[model samples]
Target chain A: MAVRTPTGSPSGRALGLGAAAALLLLVGCCTVGLSMELQGTVSLEGRLFPQASAYQGQEDYDASLVLEPELYWEGEGGLSCSLKPFLRLDTSDPERSHSDLREANLLYGADSWQLLFGLDKVFWGVTEFVHLVDIVNQTDLVESPDQEEKLGQPMLALSLEQEWGTLEAYLLPLFRERTFPGSRGRLRGPLVIDSGAAEYESGAGRTHPDLALRYSHTLGNLDLGLYQFFGTSREPLFLPSAGQEEELIPFYSQISQTGLDLQLVEGQWLWKLEALQRSGQGPGRGAVACGFEYTWVRPWQLDLDLGFIAEYVRDQRRLADDSPYDNDLMLGMRLGLNDAQGSELLLGMVQDLAQPSCFMVLEAGQRLGESLHLSLSGYLFVRTAEQDPLRFYQQDSYLLFKGSYYF
Target chain B: MKRSLMLLLLLALMPVSPLQALAETPEEQGHAIAVEADRRSSGFGDCTADTVMILRNREGQENRRQLRSRVLEQEDDGDKSLTLFDSPGDVRGTILLTFSHKRGDDDQWLFLPALKRVKRISAANKSGAFMGSEFAFEDLGSRELEKYGHRYLGSESLDGRECFVLEQIPLDSKNSGYSRIISWLDTTTYRLIREEYFDQKQRLLKTLFCREYQQYLGFLWKAHRLEMVNHQNGKETDLLFANYRFQVGLTDRDFRKNRLKNLRTGGGR
Candidate 1:
C-alpha cells in the first residue's frame, strides 16, 4: 500500500538535503556485515487555537523530524532481513512533509512455518476507543488526529502455529491511498481531500488483488481474533467535486470485511471487543465496540495507576451517511505515574448517544531525560448538533504540544 | 470440701502429648522453610540468563537494561518466563511473556516493539514498575509456595551467613503489593539472603540484596548481584546475573505468546 502522495509545495531546503543524502546512503549500505540500528524522532509541535483562515499562512508553531535507520540481516537457514527507512521533516506544514517505508521485510522461519515479504505494519484490534479490527495500514492523517498513524503495507504473509490457533495468510498487492488532512490541517474534512482525484471501484484499480485471513487464539483467560478481508476500501468515499469549486473526491469501493476481536483478562479487568462486517458497501453494514479496563493498582502512594474506561459504540449505518458512531458512548481515564520519568495520563469522552455531540480527549506524557519525550494533548467539542458528525469539528477545538527526541 | 472438688474435675480432662506435636509451631517452622526452599530449587530443568539492569536515580542518575532470559521449570504449574529486550534503543525488541501459576492468576504477555502488537498484560499491574525498574511485576515471578503466608521470624546474622528470617504474608492481598515480606534464608544453603518490602501501610517499602553466590549444576544456587533499594523512592535497582546455562532444553513450545514475535532471532540460547 502507501505510494507516497505527499502533496504540493516541495523544496523544504531540497527535502532536507535529500533526506541527508538518503540517510547517508542507507547507512553505507547497511554497514556491510549488516546488524544496524539508528533510531530517531525529534519533535516540537504546538497549536492551541488558530480558529480558521484555514490556517494556511502556517505557523501555530511546528517542527518535526524523524529518521529511523534499521537494518538487520541474517542468513543461513531461517533467513531474515529487515530494512526500515522512514524520514519526516515538517516545519509549518509543507503538506506535513513525509517519507516512509517502515520495514521492508523478508523473514522466514521453519518449524511451525512462517514467512513474510516486503513492506509491513499490521495492528488489529483490542480497543482503545477505536480501531475496529485495524484494517491493514492506511491512515497517517498528517500524522495525528490519532488514528494512530500507519501507512506502509504491501504484503505476502503466511503463518501457521498450530496447537489450535495462530494461522494467517494474506496477499494484498498494492493500493494505499489514505493520508489526508493537510490543507493546512486542523482536524480536517469540510471538503478538500483531493489527492489528484483518486477513484477506483475495482476493474482492477491499483492492481487490486487483496485478500486476507487470520485466526488467533489464547484460551485460559480469553483472547481471540478472526479476520477476513477482500479488496479496495480502506475507507475512502468523499464525492462532491464535479468540476471542483469546493473540491473533494476519493471514492474507492469494492468491500468485504469481517472481523472480531476480544480480550478479557480479568484481575483488574480489561474486557474489550471489536466487531465488524461490511460487504460491498451499499447496504450491508455492522459495527461494534465494547469495553472495560480497570487497573487501580498502587492507588496513591506516589506510585500511582488508575485506568477506568468504558465503551459502547454502534453503527448500522445510522442514517446511511457517514456514520460517526450511530450511538456512541465512551468514557475514560488513565493515569499511570509508575515513576522514573514515565508518567502518563489520558482522559476521554465521546458521547453522542443520539447527538448532543461530545468528543473530548486529553492526553499527557512524560519522560524527558532518557531520550526525551513530553506531550500534552487536548481536543474538545461539545453540544454541536447540526446533525453532529462533529459538525465539521466545530471550529476544531484544539491544544497540543509535543516534544520528542529519541535516538 | 467434696473431696477437693473431685480433684479439680480430673484436672480439666487432660490429654496432650506426642512431645507437644513434635515440638514444631511458628507456622510449622514457616512451612518448613518454604518446603525447604522449594526442594532446593528443584530439577534445574531449563535456564539461560544474561541480565544487566542498573537504574539508579535520586541524583545518582543512571539507566541501563539488556536482558535475555528463558526459564521453564514447571513440574506442577508456576514457571515459564521469557524476557528479551537487549539494550535500549527504546526498549529494543521488547517481549515479556510470563505464565506462572499455582492456584490462580498469573499470565502476562507484552511484546510491543512499537506496537506490532501482543499486549494482554493485566496481571493487574503486580505492583507496577518493572521496566522503569525498581523491579516489581511482583518482583519477577516464580515465588510459588502457594503464594505465601508463613511466619517463623527468628534467627540472625545475615551477611555473615547463618540467617533464616521468614515472615511472608500475601495470599493475594488483593493481588499483593506487599503487606509483608521479610525473608533472609541461608542457614546452610536455603540461599535467598535478604529482602524486606512491607507497604500496604505496614511501611518499610523495599530493600533487597542477594549478592554474589554461585553454585550452578551442583544443585543450582545462582545469584550474582540483585540490589533493589527504593525505600520510598530513593530509587535503585541492580540485577546483574550473567550467562548461567543449565538444562537448556525448554518446552511448552518455548513459552509461547505466539513465541513473542520472533523473540530475537532463534529465541536466544
Candidate 2:
C-alpha cells in the first residue's frame, strides 16, 4: 500500500503565523486584569473491523489517542480570546496522525456589533441526517466518516445585531483542503487520492479570498437562516493524475452558493429544511434535505424520551456529487434515559432510493463518573451498488469504542 | 308602624363595602391570592443566579451539576430565561433558552457546544424529568396566574407560620405532568412555602419545600434552597442557589437565541 503525505500550503502557513502574532499582541496588551480558564479532554479510541479488509496491509483492529485543550481569556470591555488545539495519534494509519487548531480567535463585542479574527468554526444547518448548508469549514474526513468533525477555517467575521435579525459577513482568507484516508486505511477507496498534487481553478489557488454573508432570525416558533457564499468550493472533484492512473488528484473549483435553512417547532414535532442552489462546479443545480423529528416524553410511564426522525434528501447533480445522500430516505430513533449518567442511544438507517444500497449507524454513550465518559458506535454498509461511491466501504463495517477523560 | 318603616328604610340606605357585604367564593378568593402573589414577584426587571444541583437515587448515589441562570422579566408575557450548564464536564457549555408564553406552549432552543448548533426543541416535554432530576421542566418555568385554575383550600399553620393552602389544576392537562398542585403560601409575604404535586392518576408524586428565604431589594423574597423528593420512586433532588443578583440590567438581547452561542462555560457572570 502507498503512503501519501498531506501537502502544506505556503500561504496558509504564513496566515497562521500572522494570526498567532496578532493573538500574542492582543494578549500582551490586555493581561493587566484578565480572567483565564483552561479546560480540555483526552480520549483513547479502539476500532474493530468485523470483516477482513478489501485492501492489503490493513489491520482488523486499530487504536488511537486524542488530545484537545481549550484556553479562554476575558479582558475588559467585552474583549475575549479563545485558543483550542486538537491532536490525534493513530497506531495503524500514518495519515490519521495529525494536529490542527480548532479555534484561535480574538473577539471584540460591542453593544450591537462584534468582530472575530483568526481560525474559527461555524455551523449553519439544523437537520439531523446531513448539513446541506454548512460549508464554512472543511470536513475532517480522517477523524470520522460521519462528517460531524470539521477542520477550522481562517477568516475575519463581523456581525451586526438589530431588531429585525442578525447579519454577519465573513472574509475567509485561507481554505483548508479536505482530508482523506490513507491507502492502508480501511475506509479508503480502490484508487488512492494524491492529496499532495491538489489543483485549483483559481489563479491564486488556496490563497483565493472567499466571501460569505448570512442573516438569521427567529420569529414565534420558527427559526430561519439565509446565506450566500462565493469562493472556493469545499467539495472537490477528483481527476486522475496525468501519468499515474492509479491515483486521483483533487480539483478545487470556484463556485457560488446560496442557502436557506429553517426550523419550525410545533408541539412535539420539529420540522427542518435545508435547501441550496449552487453554480461553477458543473451545471447550476439545487439540493434539499428536509426532515422532521417528533418526540414522546415519558411514553407509557417510562422515564425516558423517544424521538423519531424521518428525512428525505435529494441532489440534482446525482452521481456527479460526492455525497451518497443524493437520493435517499433516512429514518432514525433516539432514546435518552435522562438518568444521572446521561445515557443516550441513536439508531439510524439511510436507504438509497434509486439503488439497492443502504447504510446503518448506531451510537450509544454514557458517563462513567464525573470526569470520564464512554461511548460506542458502529457503522454498517449493506449491499452497496457497484456504481455507488460507498461500494469501496462495503466490507469496512466496524465498531468503535472510545473513553474520554476531562480536566 | 310608620316610625318602624322609617327605621328599616334608613338601615337599607346605609353604605355597605363589597368586602363586608358579600361573602367571597373559594374560587374567586384563590384567584385573587394568586394574582397578588404574582404581582408581588413581578417587578425585579431581571435576575441572575448560580445553582448547584444534587441528584440522589434510591440507593443514595449522588451526582452534582452546576449551572448559571439569567432571566429577563416581561411585562406583558411570561419571563424569558436562559440556563447554561457548567459542570459534569461532558455537558458543559450546553445552553437552553426559553421564551415562556402565558397562554400557550413555551418556545425552547438548545445549544450544543460541540456542534456549535442551536436546535429548536419541542416544548411539549413538560412531563419529562429535567436533567434526570425530580423536578420536571414545567416546575422550573415561570409560574403564570392564567396557567392554572385555583381554588382556595383555606388557611393552615405550617412550621409555625400562617399559610394559605390553594389547590390548583393545570389548564393544559394534555401537556402538564401533574393533574393538580397544592401549594402553601405564607399569608403575610405571599411567598411560596411548599408544594405537593399529584400525577395524572391523582396520586401524590412529589413534594417540594422552599427553604432559606432571603429578602432582596427590601421587598423581593427569594428562596435560596429547594428540595424535591419523589414519593413513589424514593429519589430526591436539591437545588442550592447562590450569588443571586437582581435588577442586573439584563435586556431582550441577552435572552435571544443568538446570544446562546456566546455563553461561556465554567460559569459566566
Candidate 3:
C-alpha cells in the first residue's frame, strides 16, 4: 500500500508550491473593476474504522485538516482567469497529506463561441454508481478512496454553440498519472501502486497529445451527448515488475473510445444510459450502464421528494472481467428536502449479481450556515468474495465527516 | 318596501359585471375574461426586474434570496424568461432559463456553477419546489390563455374592489400537480389579485395574494408584492418585486442556453 511520490526531492516540492502562488499572482493582475473574488474552505475531516487493521501500530482513528482556496478574476470583454489550489495536512501521517492544483484556466469570448486554456476539469456520463466514460482528468485517489476527486488536466478547449447543439473540441498536451493512497493511509489495496514506475504504449511517451470531440444537445425531453476520444487510457493495467524484488508497475495503453450518454425525462421518471466501446489494451469490448429514477414530489405534503433508482451495468467480458461491474445491479434512494439549507440524502447499493458481493454507500450533505456546509459519507462492503476487488477492504468500512466553511 | 327600493338603487350605482353585457355561457364568459387579461398584458415587448424572496418555515424562521429577472414577450407563443440568483453566495451565479410553449410542455434549463454545466431539468417535475422555496416552478411560468380550461365563478368584492372569480383547470393534468385553481381578477384592470390552488387529491394546498399594484409605462399593471402560503406544510414564500423596466429591448439571443454561462450580472437590457 506504499505510494511513491513522483516529486520526492525538496526542490521539486518547492517548485510545485511556487507555481501555485504564481498562478494566483497572474490572476490578480488581470482583474477589472476589482473583480477578484476570493473563496475557499477550511475543513477538518475524521475517519472511523469499525475493525482494527492487521498492521501493528495502525491507529483506528485518523484526522486531517484541508484548506482549499480559489481565486477568480473576471475581466471585461470576455477575459477571465481562475486558480484553485488544495492543501491537506494530515496529523497522523505526513505522506498521506498532499497538494493538488484543481484548476487554473483562462477563458475568452462571450456568447456563441469561446476558448479555454490551461489546466481545467471536465466531467461526463450520467450514472451515479460508476463513471464509465468520464476519463478526461486523472483520479485524485489520495484525497478519498471513492475516487470522486480529480486532478487538473492541462488542455485547450474550443466550444461553439449552435441551434442544433453545442460542439466542443479539446486538445490535451500533457498526461497526469493517477495518485494512490500512501502506506500510512487506510482503505487501500494489498499491492501498492507505484506511480513513478509507469510505462506508456505510445513511443512519444507522456508527450503524446490527446484529442477529444464532444457534442451535446437537448431535443425535446431527451438530453443526448456523443463523445470520441483518442488518447491514453486512464485505467492502467497493473503488473508486477520482472525482478527479484516484487514491485507493482502500471502500464498505460493508447486507445480510441466512443461513448454515448442519454437521459430521457417523462412525468416522474428519468431514464439514463451511458455506453462506451473501446479497443487497444485488450480485446475490443463494449460496456453499458442503464438506469431509471422515479421521483415523487412533495410526498405526503412534507416539503420533500423521494426518488427511487435502479440501474444495471454490464461488460462484455463477463466472468473473466477485471472491470468492477461485470453483471451488477445498483439500487438507490434519494431524499431531497426543499429547505432553505439545501439538505439532501442518498443511499445506494451495488450488488454483483454473478457473485456473492455487494457494496453499500450512504451520502448526506446540507448547508450548515450562510457560508458553512456539512457532509457525511459511509462505505460498507458486505459478503465480498475473494475474487472481488472490494474484498481487500472487507474490514475497511468507515464513516467520513466533513465540515467546510466558505469565505 | 320603501327601504328595499333605496337599497336597490344604491346597488345599481356599484360596478356591474362586464360579462352581463354579452349573452354567453359560463365557460365562454370565463374564456373571454382570460383573453382580455392576456391581451391587456401584451405588447410590452420586454422587461427587467429585481426580486427578493423571503421563505418562512412553520416556526417562522426566515431565509431570503435575491434574483434578477429578464423577460421577452412573445406575440403568439409563450414567453421566454431568465432568472439569475444574486444572493446566498452558494447559489450566486446560478441561472434558470424557461421557454414556455402554448400547446405542449415547457422547457427549462439550469446552469449550475459548481458543475460548470447547463442541465436540462425535467419540465414534468413542475410540482417540485423552485430553489427550495414554497413556490413551485409551475407558479413562475407565463400565464398563457391556451394552457388552461376556464369556468366562470360568481363575482365577489375583495379588499373593497369588485373582482371576477374563475375556476381554471389544467388542460394537461398529467404533469400538473393541481386539480383546479381559483383565481380572482380585478374587474376594472384585468389584474390578478388572488389565487387558490387545489392539489391533485382535491385538497386545498396553497393560497397566493397579490397586492400593491403599480402601473408601468402608464398602461401595464404589475403587483409589487406576491405572497404564497402553503397550508399543508405551513411554509410561506413572499416575493417583493421592484425596479420594473419595460421596453428594455431583449431578444431571443439573450435567452439562449449557451449565453447563460457568460451572462454578466445585471447587464442584459
Best by TM-score: 2
Model 1 chain A: weakest 10-residue lDDT segment is A1-10
Q: Give me the overall lDDT of model 3.
A: 0.78
What is the C-alpha lDDT profile of model 1 across B56-133, one tens digit per residue?
988998877678888888877888888887655445677888888887888888888666788886885587777778
DockQ versus reference, model 1:
0.17
Error of model 3, residue B262, in angstroms: 5.4
Highest DockQ, which number?
Answer: 2
**Could you tell me the lDDT of residue A68 within candidate 1?**
62
TM-scores, all candidates, are 0.32, 0.95, 0.87
lDDT tens digits, residues A312-352, model 3? 99876322213568779999999999789989999999999
DockQ of each two-chain model: 0.17, 0.62, 0.33
- Top-scoring candidate (lDDT): 2
lDDT of 3 by residue, B34-97 (tens): 8767767877999999999999989998888889999998766789999998766567668999
2 against 3, candidate with superior lDDT: 2
Q: After superposition, how far is residue A275 of candidate 2 from its true place, in Å?
A: 0.5
True contacts kept of each: 0.42, 0.76, 0.36
Q: Which ten residues in a row have the lowest lDDT in candidate 2 chain A?
A: A1-10
lDDT of 1 by residue, A40-87 (tens): 455666666656533344344555666665555555456566666666
